[model samples]
Target: MNLTIDEIQDFKGKYPKQIWSLFFSEMWERFCFYGMRGMLVFFMISQLNFHEKEANLQYGATQAFVYAFTFVGGLFADKILGFRKSLFWGGLLMIVGSLILATNPHDFFFLGIAFTVVGTGFFKPNISSMVGQLYKPNDSRADAGFSLFYAGINLGALLGGYLCIAIGKGEIFSSIISESMRWNVAFGLAAFVMVISLINFVFTQRSLGTIGLQPGHPESELQSAPMPKWKEYGVYILSLIFIPIIMKMVSVPEYTDYFMLTVGPLTLIYLFYEMSKVTAAERKKLWAALVFILFSILFWGIYEQSGGSLSIFAAKNLNKDLLGLDPNGVNNSGGAFFIIFLAPLLGLLWIWMSKRKIEPNTIIKFGLGFIFLGLGYYVLFATRLFADLQGITSLNFFTIALLVITLGELCLSPIGLSIMTKLSTKNLQGMMMGMWFLASAYGQYVAGIIGASLVSTNENASNYDALITYTEGYKQLAIYAIIAGVVLILISPLVKKLMQGVK
Candidate 1:
């Protein structure tokens, strides 16, 4: 399996570094993305004066829209701009958005969110798709390379949590910086990291060669056939300008759901159109992809609690002030520190298995992932027996819980991207990627809605009383998520067959 000098030289000057360079580029981008996400909900509730319930919903909507639009972005890249250009444009827009986000002025909040939505729309899916482009068909290194890419993402996320959020959290601990800089520090860091990402990609673009091409060029582009993708994306963008009006029309209590209602149909229509163009074998792949999509919703619905319920859990119950760390702190840092180390070890584990030709099938791995996730949460569920939910608990409980949760994340999150690439038909890869991201969108939306119940209050209740009422809701979700994971494992065999031997 060792690459010879002559073989390695073949790739030299022909696109000098493919996988690692893209890996680093995505790493920095996730740094900016995750850093901001770590602070978003608390920033809303604390700084903006949002009710706990209201802030969570808004956070949910913001996150959901960001991902849902990746559906548009994947199409846009596949059909129009190509991945490199789309990524560059997305990065540029995100820098601008970060500048807007760094400001504390109320006027900037919605504007920042708007810019970020469009920016992420162009960013998220295209980069991962390009990772698949790094390998030749059936190259065993493909999944391992993606695992490396996942490690890169966590590296950034871990840094963002420790360096970015913890730095901003300084206000809670010390008055060294004015309140003016407290919120801005995280955004400012995001801006700086993103600029580095932009520079890295701009310089490395030539090395990627034909990896992210649009649908049509020549037979040299891939097969001697025509291709198409972004028309649906264009329509989607056009539809986005009307979403405000549509949201108003629905008149639902939760405007976020109304918004999702509008976009959900568009996602379906796009999928239907993509499916119309594929063969039976490829279509079976799509069905398998559908099973992944369903399972993904379940997976992320619980895992995404890191940004919502679990985050709140850290603030209220966890020993936030442990070892002199402040309760109202920003970084939410240590958990990610464990992730930084664990992710790579897991990456190497996967690669080691691949080299031995002992790779687990995708669905089986997915099933195992759920068991790990359930195990992680049930640890917290066990803590309830020993610790009082009605009183403060030691942060050690949360730290241990997150460590286990991160292990579960290591199992599933990395592999999901690899699965998307394998399961896709060439014509529908972009669409399938978008659909995959949509599961995340829905999961965030659900997390937000669920988080609200965890802390929501009745109008008649005192604020303190309402908070107590809401935390109980979180307890229920903890139980619910644990149960859902088991059900997913039970159904794993059915999904494995639907995959038709893709693994």
Candidate 2:
């Protein structure tokens, strides 16, 4: 799968120019995605009258499906329609889903969520696969390229988060609309972003050249004909059938857990099957990829709380005033702004380190990710002592914790994207990319369980009660992160050997 010599020689700048198109497309897609995400739990608790635990469970179920479906979507892209077609189809479904939510906020919330889950399944993994496709095998720019893409995602997140709060709080829609109608405005904005993303991709996709074209079966008898229409339509019908099932799963926590339990082992079996087919060296690389994937579940389980527990804590406990903006919106924007400023520097740093042969290997980078995650939680944990001693949530301490977590994210997230492409065999690229997000699916499910456990049932609980709950959660998560980081570092040498020459 290595790019031919001319393609490799074409890397003349910090990034391939086509990445900007992908960047803006993903940015808007993320704008739509996170715009809804930033407000989901708040919307549930406020408008839908959901208890905190119920909200957490529901959030977990939805996020899990959003990611878990990527595996199915990836298979569709790899085996039937190619990446470009999948992305377009997925985008259309998402737009429809977002509009559904905006149009009937009370009646169709879960239904809207279902459309998004299926739509994202097809869209998210393949866009990432396309980013990897833009490079040749062993391309040094690959990690940096993914970092830039990751930054674009967060940039959308920052803007989307701001819009979510602005509209939700009646800051923008207050003049012409009542407070009750403001949320609809936010959801409508999310749909609008997706529309823009689809339009942009339609125009710029030719820049991708032949990267995602489908292949004909090599058998001479079948090579000339296209895939049968019924088969393609049958897959579409099968995918549609899952929407109701996922909608049901998200409505109940136990069902969601059971779904992941069933999916996790089946996915592992697929990986094992693939490993059996590869040569020994390639098998080792895949094993290393699995090791990272396993630990990533833990990393993401802790990291994903920002959308669930952490967001609640910010809205309830933290100082919200940042120049009259909603605190949750500001908090949500903080990490994205950090990513925008830091990503290019980090991307360039990777390039510089690659040139000097001093870049940290993937295992070590993952370990760093864990360490920072641990540190971020520990920082938040320390706020509990401050709350006990001074009765303050300490906005400064909360902001600092976010910054630390963003550092951990920088180390791991994009690196995961880069290494998956490097380690996977070309034919299995989409499947493996989906598997990577499947780890996130599991992580998000675990996050829900953890967040739900911390819900305060008492409506009038004092600040101390909330403090105790958050502190205990932060302390426990911090300890797990540190343990995972230490263990990964301990095994880095062996993992490095397994990586076989991949950096």
Candidate 3:
């Protein structure tokens, strides 16, 4: 497996060219995704009239579905359809979904979220695989390439966060605009960004056409024929049965609890089924992947609060105004803006470390991720103390906390899938990747529930509930984050051992 320069040379492209194309493409995709995400919790709790528990449940359910669909999307790309086709289908679906979202802010709102969940399922994973395809195995830069792609994710987040919230919430322009017009403008702008991302990939697919297997692999003895139309159609029909069940769960945010109950046993069944067929080393790899999977979930459960409870804290409590401009609507999406700058530096940081053979092992990196997460939460708790002690609040307090947490995120989130890809065997790659995303499904679900608990008042969000929970929930979350990090760090050696030689 020692990748000599000659082997690596075969896959090399113009690094700058490939990086730029991927960067811009991912930037827009993230913009659309995070733009909606930035507003989701606020929209659900404040605008939707949902009680804290219900809103949180819905938030978790929605995000869970988003990650869960990647399994279906990945199956399509790996088997019947090609990556280009899958990306097109996914992007087109998102555009349609985004449009539906903008059409009206009323009853169909649920429909819009449903469409987005399905659309993201289609889009997220495959495009990422394509970025990895950009580099050859021996090229030492694979991690950096993945990191670059991740930066694109946050770039889009920053744009969406700032622009969408500004337009949707209208603190900057509320005096000059109407709510519906502003909101629609924000949504429409996101749709436009999606279209552009789709366009970039569509035109450029021919260049990397050799990367994804089904496209480049000859139709031969090695290639499996497409599933019969009947079988494909049958799976589609089975999927239809779940649609009603999901719709039925709309009344209960705790539906994810049911999903966990069922998926757990089913997951065990599938693991055994796969393990029965795999070689010993492959089995070890799968088990290793499973170990990382457990830690990964804990990481995201705390990390994803950015979209849930953190957003609310920023909205109702954080002092947004820094230099005297009114800060009311600014907090909604500003974290994304920070990601735009920080993500790339992190990406480059990985590249530099990899070049020097100094990058931390996967488990250690993840351990550090937890540590930073703890520190980030501690920063929040400290900031709360600072606010309470001073009786005067500044946006800087929240900004300081966010900066710390984001740096912690740099240590962990971006590299997770890359770890799974490296550590798992070939056949289980798709399944393990699917599982990785599914972990996020559960994490977001849990985060939503946790976020909802912090939301406080059912009747009015303004101050009545603020008096009840306010900063207390954040204080508690900070403590939870710190403890999780310390525990993960302690177990890092055990987890790293499970990884075998994959690192």
Candidate of highest lDDT: 2
> Judged by TM-score, which candidate is best?
2
Error of 3 at 54 (Å): 2.7
Instruction: Give the least accurate 10-residue stretch of model 2, judged by summed lDDT.
Output: 215-224
TM-score of 1: 0.85
For 103-176, candidate 1 gives per-residue lDDT tens digits of: 75255766666666777778889888877666654555566667667766667777766565565656343466
Identify the runs in model 1 with alpha carbons over 4 angstroms from their true place.
Answer: 1-17, 171-176, 216-220, 223-253, 321-323, 326-335, 354-358, 383-390, 456-475
What lDDT score belongs to each candidate, Candidate 1 first?
0.68, 0.83, 0.66
lDDT of 2 by residue, 399-452 (tens): 788889898999999999889989998878899999999999999888888888
Candidate 3 regions with alpha-carbon error over 4 angstroms: 1-19, 137-139, 173-176, 213-222, 226-251, 323-332, 386-392, 457-470
Assess candidate 2 and give its TM-score to the true structure.
0.94
lDDT for model 3: 0.66
Order of the predicted models by TM-score, top scorer first = 2, 3, 1
Per-prediction TM-score: 0.85, 0.94, 0.87
Candidate 2 global CA lDDT score: 0.83
User: Candidate 2 at 268: error in angstroms?
Assistant: 1.0
